[model samples]
Target: MNLIHRAGWRRGILALAVASLLTLAAIEVLSDEPEIALLIGEPYKAMRQRSTASIDPAIPGHSWFNAPKSDARLRFADPQFGFVTPLARFFTVGFSRDQRIDGVRMSPQIEPLLLDDTLKVVLDLQEQWRNAGWVPIRAEEFPSFADTPQWRDRLREVKNVEKAYWRAGDKYQLMLVVSRFRDNKRPTEERYLITLGIHRSRGVQ
Candidate 1:
């Protein structure tokens, strides 16, 4: 090959190598830290905004619900698993202008989710809170998991709203309710609303 041709080929090879390196660097940066806000969506954003406004005296410290959206300590709202609480410190609070349900406030703009999604939320919350001494309770109005299988098929097919109750420590109580309703924006589709609240226990401790 001529000297001129050889020089052109070397330049082309070097340019391709540099481009490949830049592409790899970009991919590494993106994979290292994904966007938590985009992963969770508007429900998370709305709850985060309200986390600081209403304080629950029973909690008595920095609210995990108030954690930044990107905080590594929180995980929630998975489509396949419903909801996940990998870290016990990651918590959420719900409040609204609407009437309270069983003495706990509800959010007016509750986001619709899938039944599977809601189930996962309840399960994860129950598991984490149980580790913290929150015992499951049976009630006429709400669903109880005490006797049911931890991994059950009957509950996964449910397409309506359901509620669960738990008591923690000596004075605090937790309530979680999941409602499946029609999507306002997409009328043909159905979605679930997963609301949670914490309050002073009214029952005998």
Candidate 2:
């Protein structure tokens, strides 16, 4: 090849290498950044506005409901949030009576998932939270069910339950529970449930 042609080829290769590096850097930054969409103390009106902007136009099944004590919930059957698995049946955000967000919860769509797949999904979520700076806490202890009647009831229906907890500095807490139960419709088969909850840390020891 001619000298000029060789130089042109070298420049082209350098340009491609630079572009690839930039793209990789961008992906790393996104992956490292926390994926929590709603801020803990953001006012209801502001959070609603921000969340509305995140709604994907092509996805459906979005609704809002009022929770106990005047708290509110925004639910999405197919959420756009990247942190949760696409298999999640519903994603819900809880807003307290004071009009500020308090927590978020999601459960995997159990009917279609095998027990192993459900366990993998739950573990993957924990890794994602850890990557976002949530430190694993209370790995050896089961979460207290006394405060949440729903969770207490869940314990009675399931077997081989496992729980994990994490904290992000002093600001946030995350809890994950995985369990399996016999399917009433199919007596010989088992069904799994994976529940993930993230909330503002209350300093509960």
> Candidate 2 regions off by >4 Å?
1-36, 52-87, 110-112, 142-158, 184-187
- How far residue 197's Cα lies from its native spot in candidate 2, in Å, is 1.5
Determine the C-alpha RMSD for candidate 1 after optimal superposition of all C-alphas.
Answer: 12.5
lDDT of each: 0.47, 0.56
| lDDT of each residue in 9-59, candidate 1, tens digit only | 999999999999999998786445422211222333443343322333222
My TM-score estimates for the predictions, one after another, are 0.43, 0.56
Model 2 worst lDDT run, 10 consecutive residues: 69-78
TM-score of candidate 1 against the unseen true structure: 0.43
Pairs with steric clashes in candidate 2: none
Using lDDT as the measure, which candidate wins?
Answer: 2
